[model samples]
Target: MALPAPNPRAMLADRGYDSDGFRQDLLIHGILPVIPSRKGRSVPQSLNQKAV
Candidate 1:
């Protein structure tokens, strides 16, 4: 599989990819993850639409 760009600005994903692990991975890679939070989450996550 092709690797991602050297330095991605951010990552956009659906609720399926909404998880702390995944978000942490993105941060570790220096990329911001813009994914909607799943239902029933203890703390709902807010999305910054302007950044997207």
Candidate 2:
């Protein structure tokens, strides 16, 4: 059976979830994504470590 989607204020994830599409989806759902950027990315994104 298909499970229901989650409705969370924020999401904590690792670099594996560091994708533009994924981040955008989370924002659209009103969820704050706390995922760090992966290595080898041209522009390194700044992350709030304290929030993790």
Candidate 3:
């Protein structure tokens, strides 16, 4: 028998995963990625508190 595939509703990550490609890939798979922004960013990032 084959193992079942992963079907997660959402994914939670930290600022370490703050990459354009990473976010785009998650979106393509229909996974809501909740990753925070890096503090060194020039512009402030708007993050959802509830999502965290």
Candidate 4:
């Protein structure tokens, strides 16, 4: 199988990929995920859309 590409500086994703585990995985690989928080989350995560 082909190897995965190098880690990107940042990733832009919607709420569908919003999860603690997923974010942790990205950080492990030195990736910055710009995912918005889900509506039901008690503590919402904030992201700067302008920078994306």
Q: What C-alpha lDDT does candidate 4 achieve relative to the native structure?
A: 0.84
The Cα local distance difference test for each model comes to 0.83, 0.80, 0.76, 0.84
My TM-score estimates for the predictions, one after another, are 0.78, 0.71, 0.69, 0.77
Say which prediction, candidate 1 or candidate 4, comes out ahead on lDDT: 4
lDDT of 1 by residue, 1-52 (tens): 9897787888888899989998998889888888889996899787756555
Work out how many backbone clashes candidate 2 has.
0
Instruction: Tell how far residue 10 is off in model 1, in angstroms.
Output: 0.7
**Ten-residue stretch with the least lDDT total in model 2:** 43-52
Tens digits of per-residue lDDT for model 4, 3-40: 65675777789999999999899889888879999999
lDDT of 2: 0.80
Task: Please tell me which predicted candidate would have the highest lDDT against the true structure.
Answer: 4
lDDT of 4 at 35: 93
Error of 4 at 28 (Å): 0.7
Native-referenced Cα lDDT, model 3: 0.76
Q: Which candidate number has the best TM-score?
A: 1
Show the colliding residue pairs in model 3: none
TM-score-best of 2 and 4? 4
- Candidate 2 similarity to native, TM-score: 0.71
